[model samples]
Target: MNAPRTLRAALVYFNDFENCQRFMIDLRWPDGVVRCPTCGSDKVTYLADDKRWKCYAKHPRAKFSLKVGTVLEDSPIGLEKWLPAM
Candidate 1:
């Protein structure tokens, strides 16, 4: 009987929210143009204390997380767990 091949994957996951935030920031706004994800407004602000993005356009969804509008939406799991799963 041949045993099933169980592939072991070693994922280097980062638990630091800042690291994850920086990574997403780099991917979404590679040119340093941090626009509002909701309204596409370039006048967006970064709340380092809250670790989120705020849009100055006065929209319903002004404040957003790095996970907003992404595959991580509506997921309660933290980035540490999510990265490993990916």
Candidate 2:
């Protein structure tokens, strides 16, 4: 659960999809609140099935994934593979 302390642990820790998601969430929103990257609205709902979030703030870009505003944004690569590499 704690951040990976070494390369081997990071490889294993980031291999799981859920772990990668949780890590990104914590890294981006340390306050434990997921916000809309576009509108910066706290009024967002997680779409678990799609692995994304939807903001209720009447905006064009209402849906986003954890990588939306990060350097990983728009990449086709999965977080499980990306996090460890980073």
Among these predictions, the greatest TM-score belongs to: 2
Tens digits of lDDT, candidate 1, 1-86: 12113323213424656556666677678885878888888888889888788998987989988788789979999765675565
TM-score of each predicted structure versus truth: 0.74, 0.91
Backbone clashes for every candidate come to: 0, 0
Summed over model 1, clashes come to: 0
Deviation in angstroms for 71 in model 2? 0.9
Q: Which has the greatest lDDT?
A: 2
Q: After superposition, how far is residue 80 of candidate 2 from its true place, in Å?
A: 0.6
* Clashing residue pairs, backbone N/CA/C < 3 A, model 2: none
Q: Taking the tens digit of each residue's C-alpha lDDT, what string does model 2 give over 1-86?
A: 49898889999999998899889989999988999999899999999999999999997879999999888997899898888888
lDDT of 2 at 9: 93
Q: Which stretches of candidate 1 lie over 4 Å from their true place?
A: 1-13
Model 1, position 40: C-alpha lDDT score: 86
